[model samples]
Target: MTTDAPVSAEQQRREEELVERVLRSFDGCADPRLATVMRSLTRHLHAFLREVRLTEQEWEAAIAFLTAAGHITDDRRQEFILLSDVLGASMQTIAINNEAVGSATEATVFGPFFVEDSPEISIGGDIANGATGQPCWVEGTVTDTTGRPVPGARIEVWEADDDGFYDVQYDDGRTAARAHLFSDAEGRYALWGITPTPYPIPADGPVGGLLEAVGRSPLRAAHLHFMVTAPRCRRLVTHIFVRGDDLLDRDSVFGVKESLVKDFVTQPAGTPTPDGRVVDGSWSRARFDIVLATEEEQR
Candidate 1:
């Protein structure tokens, strides 16, 4: 490896001048917050370049990588989101915006697979509308931080199948393994899904190449997604991970939290399900009681 020479005093002075000029260009921004963000972003970006002593070839390579990512993105696949997730940017942003408030459930990254207007299922209904996996029984209660039940809260849930592929990843135009349901009068809800299994983020794109180059794995922990909302409560987008999942500590998206890990108790075949449903094989069950902060508390 060739050694990089230390930046000389004159070169450092010139670099600082360039950064100041770039910052000054944003002075006329009418939005005060926007101006501040732009200035700070410019400073950090310039500092990073200076620290790395980035070469022209490396900058060109970065541009090409971004171009490839853009080319591979589509309505079904989001390369940029995968890139952000692998880089820990998505989790970092979530942490910054979702400070812990009382005992409200912690928030995590919103993976790119979420789709709007998912079919709604009734309480105790099955969400696995044909996707393959071991059956899972999910039950939970929605409550405010004060322990009052929050009935009628909408809970949207989704996850990859046992094969580690979301329905959207297929070209069949079918929806499965995802649905939304509302809490009952008692703020309780239950549904049937599949046990989550560890899966790698899409590994055929620029982001995947970057991870490999940096000696990183793209595997996310086994988990199920949830987005809960109510009239007077802060919206929650989070996941409950399998407690014993081997990949929990090394989730590709860095979305795991101690509070979000839960046990998926295994039930042998012939065991009666909560709703009197029958299963031909073993299944799992989990409970995730959620508490939401009020809108005012979120502020």
Candidate 2:
């Protein structure tokens, strides 16, 4: 037989007291929502430490790794984003925020290479700008989920060259392989660009070290990035992966979606382009139709 005894609040352990102190620190936060988030973050972080029974050496190593990531980051390179991508944080956030909705194009990561103020091009113009690769004709239409055409829509497109490097990666500082175009009265748009090619993320940095440590490849599948916008539709950022890409099953950033893959039909040399442009060698063509979610749907 055992006698029952009541425990007092004074019996709280040191770990429990520390957690309570951190939570109490959030009490003075001016914003209620921020306070709520801080409270949750404090609880989760402390719990993680407890669960892992993390040692001081491990904590210091983590701090050093993050510091190195920050040191390598700059205006053109985003080491933090690469870190988040490799850690699956970026993709997880994207998944939580962009659940699939009826026929609206699926969203993906706005990758590290994106830059503001890309040059605009007319329909049928070439965005490759002499980048080395086989010519590819990309034609598509912008429409709403209801199947109505979205005239005057703006579409920004960018891709890596055959060598798997973006325009910004070169020391020359000249832009190529990217352009912005407007939809026609019938919502049709077309432009010429280089065929998409697989490329590894910058491997000379801390993110690369982390990938190597974990035995993860830094290669992303071949794809074309697009940012489409219309007056009443939500802005869509996405990618169209090349069909039959070997890396589709293992995109380093976890950015691929089945609906976004499309066929890039090969055309032999001497075939007339849709816009009657002269081509001396083999070329390719792909057609992708974009559907936008309405403002209400976005809300």
Candidate 3:
């Protein structure tokens, strides 16, 4: 192991001048927001480099890592989002954009697994769609903060199967364990899904290597994804974590909120499901009442 040489006063001054030059380069940006973001990013990036006394070798290594991340990203996977999630950047952005509004459900990181045009299911329909896992019954209601029901809200739900694999990972063009459904006239929604199990974020790529180098676990807690939208309300993208999941305190994405943890009551064999559906063995049930902030309230 080699030690870094002490930084000289002249070297520090030159570094500062270089940072200012980079920031000034963005002054001509037509977009005010873009200009501001670039200036701040330059300042912080330079500061970090100075604080760490980053070496040329380290910089080269960082570039190589980013190149690997880019190489692996495709329509089915997003390595950059995984990088953001593990670094807490995604959660921070979510917190900034999703300020609490009088008991409105809190937002969390929108994991990269989400897809468009998920098959639509009706109330009490099974989203599992042949995905392998124990059956789960999910019931919920959507309402505005004032306690009034918001009928016709669209709810999109998805989760990994028991083996910690989403349908998208299979490459078979199959759509399972994900679906969209509309809330009924009473603003109530119910569906059948598999019990969510703890799973690691994709670990076969550069993000996984970074986590390993930093001694971090890639495991996310058991939870179900939900994106709800209704007329004149702020869209809510969130998750309901299983109450007793051990990983709740250390979700890899840092997405858990205490209010979003809910009990998933277990039912042994012979217990009757709410909709008179039959299960071969044990199953579970969970209820999540979601409240959304109106657009005006969100503002």
Residue pairs with backbone overlap in model 1: none
**Model 3, runs deviating above 4 Å:** 1-6
* Candidate 1 Cα deviation (angstroms), residue 239: 0.4
Q: Which stretches of candidate 2 lie over 4 Å from their true place?
A: 1-12
Candidate 3 local distance difference test against the native: 0.94
| Residue 270 miss distance in model 2 (angstroms) | 2.2
lDDT per model, in order?
A: 0.94, 0.90, 0.94
Model 3 C-alpha lDDT per residue in residues 71-177, reported as the tens digit of each score: 99999899999999999999999999999999899999899999999999999999999999999999989999999998999999999999999999997888999
Q: Tens digit of lDDT per residue, candidate 1, span 20-116?
A: 9999999799999999999999999998888788888989999999999999999889999998898889999999999999999999999999999
**TM-score of candidate 3 on Cα atoms, chains taken together:** 0.97
Q: Write the per-residue lDDT of candidate 2 for residues 108-173, one digit (tens) a residue.
A: 988998878999999998999878898999998999989899999999999999999999999898
Q: What is the TM-score of each candidate against the true structure?
A: 0.98, 0.93, 0.97
Which of the two candidates, 2 or 3, achieves a greater lDDT against the reference?
3
